[model samples]
Target: MFSFRFSNGPAAALLTAAVLLTVPGCTGPGAGQAPATSGPASGGGSPAGTASPGPPGVFPVPAATLSIPQVVKDVEPSVVTITTQTGIGSGVIYRGDGSIVTDAHVVEDQQRQPFKSVRVQLADGTQTNASVIAIDDPTDVAVIKADRSNLPAARFSTATPEVGDLTVVIGTPLGLEDTVTSGIVSGLHRNMPPSREQPQGALDLIQTDAPISPGNSGGAVADATGAVIGLSEAYLPPSSGAVAIGFVTPSATVTNVADQLLKNGKASHAVLGLVPADLSPEIVQRFNLATTTGALVIQVSPAGPADTAGIRAGDIITSFAGQKITQVTDLLAALRKAQPGQQVDLTARRGTDTKTFTATLANTSNTG
Candidate 1:
């Protein structure tokens, strides 16, 4: 099994205690344990029209390049230190009206409730009381409102950064405010496995080599141009001792979810409402099935799209929308890429027979 650290920033003992008591089936990484898996590429390649310079890092840094100090000066003010009763993390000023955006897990207490009185500390050492406006649990995004205004909102870029592009992480790790670390965009669109805290899992994650430690959660991962490209989330450590790998939520997804939370009081996502298990050779042989690859429906939500469409347990899902469903991840990625109220075709294998069904996705946030 793959292992990862959520990178929450609290002292190891406190974090472990809190997590064990609250997050069911989720365990924090021990000192020497390393990640068991590798992540997908972030599409790092030479820019179009620019000749490949043999390989990355072959060319020297340009003389006029913006220094690390310049990046810190340009973006530090917009990053804030977020403290809850149980943990400390980071946040970015979302708008001028005193709204802040951070990882939902950062502001939530062990019970997953928004802390009654969260505190936001500005770069100037100004502390303001904030209230949770909305929390998107599935996506791990949250919006909070503070009493103060005229905050410096961080500039966000929807353009995905190329792999090898400079990535800077600004956050309050270990309670140290305005700390900055630099690395390259290692990969993008990586789909991390689901956890009890986030059952839907994190999709389209931007992977970087930046040292994202505890307290860097919800911090900003800015590109070389000083545009916010992603939000620091988690890291994977090498088991045998190697440089740890980090993951960030892309800025586009963060902005989109934040906007939805601001406007609709919740972030909406397409839901099929079915519990799925990966189909394997053993399962197929035991059940005497036809295909080796696909997701086997183990449970279906009543009145949800999947159930209403006549999908049943023991059925192997072969395809969803236009995407082939070889495993549970493919189905999840396809659903995440779709929108609510969208109708799509679903193919499944039932007792040596293949059946097709139409399903209209719904928002679990809005629907029962």
Candidate 2:
């Protein structure tokens, strides 16, 4: 199933490899995480008559430290809660003109229905109506427009965030408005498999340890200084004892897609127009392939880039552009970094023969 939020309330649902869980809401791709207020505050009040700790006993530092709480206060206003007819999720104000950015899966109905009216809850709890302007399903990004103005637009950082950098996620998670969770950037360039909502899947996702629940999708993932580094996307549930892995769309991609959507009503992504399968021992034996790694071309669209480059269905793509392609995801990752009309080199194997070709990229939305 797609990862969009479900119509039901926020609760962790059992998920199978086939069923993609949404952030929360109705049980789709993205909603938000559970509430951050799961427990009582630490260091509860001291006894009424107890005196403050003496100097030798070590007095608590007052206003002597910088903290994330201050960052939250500064950044929360740019995050918002988005509710459609069937689901609820989060979004970020991308422009003062009332343009908002969110996960496409959030507003996507069960049947991949057309855009519909949505209610946006701002940080101050003010509500406004919005219209879906453009959606890029391949990247799971969408842009919407509201009639209102003077919105709190989020500021983004251009500097790349390193692994282990402090991070905080802000969103309307678990139906909780303006929730904030803290963690660190744990990884980068993570590739997620295709789901019902994203046919080609998402590439180069920012991985974090922050608590991202069902409603967290489309929310802001800020650095320690409060500059948005990415947009919360999805989180991985415990598997084989592994836990707390969340993902986000990096700020660079967000800016590029949002800019394109605002300007052209759609975002452009390079397309190969071919079906690819990962090379494995089973696939190797089944297809009598020449290699046990790389992406196998199963079908090439007529007149598409691969077809025009003389790539056949039986060819194994070993590399694309300047990167080595070990699987279909590698090809996808490379494609995301390219633009339409860009020429890229490809290396493939046909039987025992290895050949190279240059293919011009094309936009999937343009072709369709």
Candidate 3:
């Protein structure tokens, strides 16, 4: 995970909580009981590159005490090496057949360069040329089916994670093969920016300190049960380090959306028909912030929800259907609580006066 400056800080826990993942009590390390499995090669940097181990006292969450040699033996056959003829990444077997899950950006034409071919290298030393089965570009998740079925499958956790469980990341980073890293779940309920690299507005993600690298995308993050929890994504770089601070996509979201792609090659979502932005504390002061809370409205789409609701520019959102809006993330989170065609009661501030309006949510579609 990337590091944020801690000098003038929030709390020691907040720094640890960033790049956060939800960790369950018994699944993490040192809160007392010994770990049943111990996994290693943990810390920031590409699975192939190294700067230095985490500052002396920083220890890793216990990986399955199960030995790496054994893990490789049991899991490697299912853990295939991926190469795009020009790029590299890792994948996980999601079914008994040869179907694998990896980052969409890892397999398709990305902003960096278009991929020529994506080949999977099996553990038996057999290499097979593969084609994309489907991709969820919105979420940056992709699925590729091998030529055969009856393949070994990775395990997934059916249980929900707590706030402090140990999290393990397994991947082939920076072109390296079968690497592992560890860290605590920093925090949860996160949302990342939408961009060319990531189309799906960042959904629920498991924040972790586990070291992630270039090749780690689409790799697995499992709990102590050896059940998959999330898919490794990008690193959140600390303003200070050359190495990146990493993130992962939650497995639940992956499972929910992948099936749709395989079935129809696309998914549907809702669009607000507006661009949201942050309202700085300074701006809050100048505008008297209505109530010092809510997403700041910079622009309203013509004939869109805001305009239809009679909302205008410079209005700071104070509440959404009765829920307080502190930031853009808060508003987005609230959006999920509603459905298309439903009325969304919005409260905004224009100077010292407060007002509320109702805008009907719109249904939108996405294919990744």
Candidate 4:
């Protein structure tokens, strides 16, 4: 069995030695105590109504090369350390009114319940209380309103980061605040399938080698120009034979979800209303599938988008929109890029017959 763990807090006794991936946030009885482990686990501008100082990509990029020290100086003020009764994590100052952005899991208690209010520590060491505003579990993004204001909000980049772009991560890892690490964008559009350990299931993440660790969740992942491009989410532990492999939530998603949360106190996601699973060799042999690659429709929701489009359980999704669906993650990534109420074409195979259907995506609400 493949195992994944959340990179939260200092390394506690292994919840399960088999776990591989982890979200980097400290969660336990105390910030000093080792946090419990689990299996594998945006946006710029003045989000919606609240007007902040900086907008997305407002920072000026140096024409020649990026100065690491200068980048750190620009972004550190916008980064803050977040502590709850359970443990600590990191967050970014989202607006001048003290709206902070962080991973949903960061504010979740040991029981995975979100706290109504938590403690926030500014870069200058000023501590204040913050109330949970909204949380989008599917995307693992959350917004909290701090009791303080006149803060320097970090500039988020609207432009997609290239693979080789320089990346700097600033967060409180292992309860050490204001830690900074550097690396380059390793890849893009990386997807994580839904698992018991990480039900949220990330889509279209920015892969980086920025040494993300425990307590790094919700921290800033900035580009060469000091523009916030992503937030540290999870990392593959070195025991998994992985090195410098970490995943970040891209800025576009951060802003999109943050804006919705700020305006509506909820975020909407495009849902196809179907349960999908990866095809196994044994299942393929048993079913005599014509193609081995594709997401197997495990179950279809009645009256849901897939059901309405005539997609039934046992059909293998071969294509979504205009993209080939090699696996469930591909479909999820495609869905993430699509908007609710939008119509798209879907192709599937039943037995040896190929069929195509137009599906109107549905909306699902996630409120804090």
List CA RMSD, all candidates. Answer: 8.0, 10.7, 12.8, 6.5
Model 4 TM-score (2 dp)? 0.86
Candidates arranged by TM-score, highest first = 4, 1, 2, 3
Cα shift from native, residue 275, model 2 (Å) = 1.5
**lDDT of prediction 3:** 0.57
| Residue-level lDDT tens digits of model 4 in 142-253 | 8999999898999887678888989999998767889999999999988877555543355778889888776788899988777889788888776776777888998888
Q: Which stretches of candidate 1 lie over 4 Å from their true place?
A: 5-65, 195-198, 239-242, 280-282
**Best candidate, TM-score-wise?**
4
Over 94-147, each residue of candidate 3 has an lDDT whose tens digit, in order, gives: 777677877665675423222445788765667787778776444556778777
* TM-score-superior candidate, 2 or 4: 4
Ten-residue stretch with the least lDDT total in model 2:
39-48
* Index of the highest-lDDT prediction: 4
Q: lDDT values of the candidates? A: 0.70, 0.69, 0.57, 0.76
Q: Any idea what lDDT model 1 has?
A: 0.70
Off by over 4 Å in 4: 1-3, 7-29, 35-66, 110-112, 366-368
Indicate the residue-level lDDT of 86 in model 3. 36
Please state the error at residue 38 of candidate 3 in Å. Answer: 27
